[model samples]
Target: MQAPQTKEEKQLDISLDELIYKVRELKQSIAGFIYKLENEYQHISWPNMMEHFGVLSSQLNSVKRLLKTSKMPLLRNYVLFPLRLSPDRDLELEKLTEGRVMAFSHEVVPDYLRTKPEPEVEERVQMMSVKASSMAPDTTQKQLTNLNKITANLLDTISVPSASDEREKDSSLKNALPQTSSQQDTNLLIGAITKGHRLLRPEPQSPMVVGPQMGQMQPQMQQQHPHKLQMPGASMGRMPSAIKTNIKAAATSHPYQRP
Candidate 1:
């Protein structure tokens, strides 16, 4: 009911313009598919994704078929010299001639476009280049001044004397220390220690009372500490006026007679 009258034909003699127009249409179709994928992929809900892929695959197949059936297969079986650049150490601009091998290095200008240098000028330049190979050294040198310690021996053996030094120190300490001769020596040591303690003892600093109602208190305190030693002249020099007054009062109250 839809297309019952249509018929299929096959000779397929296509013109170049028509073929190019078909290729452009295929390109447009592929570009439109890419545009949809980039901009409207999230918004579009695809009913059949495979069918759209199949259309693109079919387009690719048609392009392959066209290339395969053409007079020229267009295989890159041989290298075209001008398309790729290769290094040539012997390559010189002045020696370039027609049909000479050329490469796209430094300058890719054609032979006809290159202006030939003068022979005298070229010779002088070559001589100058040859003379000045280099007077300076390379960027780096062998570092002979490194901090690597080189020795004939590696094992460290500690001498017996070094271990004996600590033992010797212990023995020397035992010899240097004084030994107790008898009980008299111990008594003498005790007397010296007691004298040191007596010398280091701080003198008592009693409050001075120079005003009224303190006369009775002073006499009582002096009576209680009558045997208290008097401070030396050197110590009395550092004493305040009140301390001097108190010391004088205590000395006056002392019961010492000029015996």
Candidate 2:
């Protein structure tokens, strides 16, 4: 059986219940603020957003401390069980509360302050673009000037030949032997002189017995003295004596007189 509750216990229970109710109300308020901030985030200021979060954090801390110190087993378990069961709820709550606070403070504040665009910045960008466009013509002119200079240099190089080229032409002219009428006459005179020298030189007499004449005479001689001719062995042995006799006969023969 359960014993009856004391006055102190009843008061503690009542205070714990009040604390729990206050925590619930605070959580609801924070949720409402988060919803409002989500919808109208751009409009809200940083200080206002932070103030709301600070109040909520203080209330939550107060509630947590109260719950921790409470001796009521049912009250503590009832409040802590749901929070412990899903740790994500606390994280989500923190994200909803503090996350928006930081986002609003850092992100939203700067944007809110400078909602209107700066005329000077826009003008500066326009001026830079205009300057770049204007510079293009000057750059093209410079390029054209360089091209003209290069063309002029090329023309000068082609028109005026180098000293080496002039020297080559002069050397070619000097080396070429000219064929003037006087030079041709001199060449003809030298050829005439060479011809006269050749005419003055003594020439060797032609052989009396050529190869073809000797061949023809051999057959005729054989026919004329067929029986008188000695055998090859006797002719070889008596060749010198026969030659001496023929020479003596030719010398004794008469010289022919013209009638």
lDDT by candidate, in order shown: 0.50, 0.58
* TM-score for each predicted model, relative to the true structure: 0.22, 0.26
Candidate 2 per-residue lDDT over residues 140-204, each given as its tens digit: 79988999999999988785555346667766554443544566456445633643311121211
**Pairs with steric clashes in candidate 2:** none
Off by over 4 Å in 1: 1-23, 77-259
RMSD of each: 31.7, 43.4
Tens digits of per-residue lDDT for model 1, 1-259:
2343221111122433445656776877787888878888887667545666778788877766766764432344433345544455435632553235454454654443445566888999888877655433332122222222222122222444444566778675556556647665565456336432122223335324324534433544333222242333225433443534577677776789343
Candidate 2 residue 170 Cα shift, in angstroms, is 95
Which pairs clash in model 1?
A: none
Q: Candidate 1: how large is its RMSD? A: 31.7
Candidate 2 ranges beyond 4 A from true positions = 1-12, 70-259
Please count the clashing residue pairs in each candidate, in the order shown. 0, 0
Best by TM-score: 2
